[model samples]
Target: MRTIHAPRLLLLLGTSLLVRGGQTLRSGDHERGDVPGWVMITLMSATLVAVILFMAEEALTTMFKAAMDKVNNP
Candidate 1:
């Protein structure tokens, strides 16, 4: 003859019941909210472009000045 602990048995039963209830209430229906993913993507792209241009500004200006000096002295 085997005996089960009352508290443990009750806890297991309660957990199983909760899990089953949750599964029954679950649904696949979802709403497409007003949040625009494209806007975030566009903003991120613009930020990257601005950072690249800012980082290269000095080098670009130096090259432009060199080109102008060569043109003027030639």
Candidate 2:
């Protein structure tokens, strides 16, 4: 599963990066000599937080299923 999952996750992240990168680059004002570094940091931070939450939820769900299976068999 790790072999299949890792590649899929990478592909998804790569696609997201390409799309978001274009949007972030285009949304900037051309007159601005430097884009705000803080904004990019914040966006990346938020994305990481969201991904963490999603993974946590998935872990909890797998644990729940395992617990239920053990109970049913015992």
The candidate scoring highest on TM-score is 1
lDDT for residue 37 in candidate 1, whole number 0-100: 52
lDDT for predicted candidate 1 compared with the true structure: 0.60
Model 2: colliding residue pairs: none
lDDT of 2 by residue, 47-67 (tens): 676677567978988999999
- Residue ranges of candidate 2 with Cα displaced over 4 Å: 1-4, 30-74
Residue 67 of model 1 has an lDDT of 100
lDDT of model 1, residue 12:
61
lDDT of 1 by residue, 1-52 (tens): 9865544555565566556545544643335332235344544565566677
TM-score of each: 0.41, 0.34
Please report the TM-score between candidate 1 and the true structure.
0.41
